[model samples]
Target: MDQQRHTQKKLDNGNIHTSPKISTHLDIEVHGAQVYSHKVLEEFQEEVKYSIDTCKIRGFSEAGSLEVTTVRDANRDRNYQVTYCQDTFKATCSCRMLERKGIICRHVIWIYSSNGVKKIPELYVVNRWCKDEIRMKMFDYNGEATEDVDIIDGKQIAMSVMWSEIHKTVAMLMGKLKADVDNFSSVIREFKEKLSLYGSPMNKQQQLKKIFGCSASQDITILPPKQ
Candidate 1:
């Protein structure tokens, strides 16, 4: 009876109430913080802090557009090779942190800092870790749109795409203006002016409806599964 009661109590509380607290610390702010979830941001910031504090640039060699940098980690007493392309802002580290865990490693962050790159490249920003809701379209074998399209809110999908494009454009421009303080200030000023022209923002309920594609009067209920 005690065991049954304990199990029943756990079921009533659900996962959120039962899960342990996750304590995270943000050391420094980065562009990833805007897009990525809190957990992902925490891990990425740790790498950034590690690169800044413990990693050292041993040397770098150039081959065409590719530059291979040797970064030594004081804590680990290990060397990592980071190959960076100046033309494309593409970087690959021998540690392969991105490949293994979908987080940029300290070695690559050290190289980026040395090269005056302020923004994390969009390529390194994993979509799975991002806070944005990504909707996937399904296609039939005949290349026709599946019934799933009818269920998803087209407006929400369109807004998501438009926001994604705007984000990419802003990220690209920010990277270009990393060293140009005058241009950067002008861009920020222009953006603020443009935003003011949009007038007052939507209320919380209206904003939620737009994002979730649900009417205020819509009923949300869970039904028992079919036997």
Candidate 2:
């Protein structure tokens, strides 16, 4: 019944309407702040400033890895070491800011600024906090790629084909149901009766758990609780 209403609305509109999505890269600082707290953002800014002022790019290795050195205080015995990869846009610091706090540290910020990198890449951004992550193509399902469409472009194509079919089918059904209420009710009732024989459909989460066996609540017996 809900599906019928949803379908009818789209049919009345004549065409499916979709809003354009804003890119995450448009305001990297805003996205970053969403993932990290304001306090962390301030600390990150200060780190970037410190990196620019106090840190120096020690040199680059043969494999395009950069080595950066930073000094927080002259009294400190050891300097911070930052390893950056130009090709992958990945940075790791011995300070473990990225590892522990899941945010870019001062050394990486300095390296990026020194290299004229204007925005943080999506690779370093956490998806749970990003607005654009939902709009992006989903690469994997059940611990593997959907039909092996692992890459972004490939997954986009797969999703486009899927949504197109769904829209077309729903729109067609909606138009039919809107034209004849009695027929629609009769058909839905018959469908429900027939479906009752097979039991109800599994929700998305249940379906995924069945496919991947990753349900946290799955039962396990350990020596029968030492009976």
- Please list all clashing residue pairs in model 1, or write none if there are none: none
Global CA lDDT computed for model 1? 0.73
Q: Which ten residues in a row have the lowest lDDT in candidate 2?
A: 15-24
Candidate 2 at residue 112, lDDT? 73
Off by over 4 Å in 1: 1-29, 135-227
lDDT of 1 by residue, 194-218 (tens): 9889885677787767766786766
On TM-score, the leading prediction is: 1
Query: How well does candidate 1 score on lDDT at residue 174?
Result: 62
lDDT at residue 218 of model 1 (Cα atoms): 60
Clashing pairs in 2: none
Please give the CA lDDT of all the candidate structures.
0.73, 0.58
lDDT of 2: 0.58
TM-score between candidate 1 and the true structure: 0.49
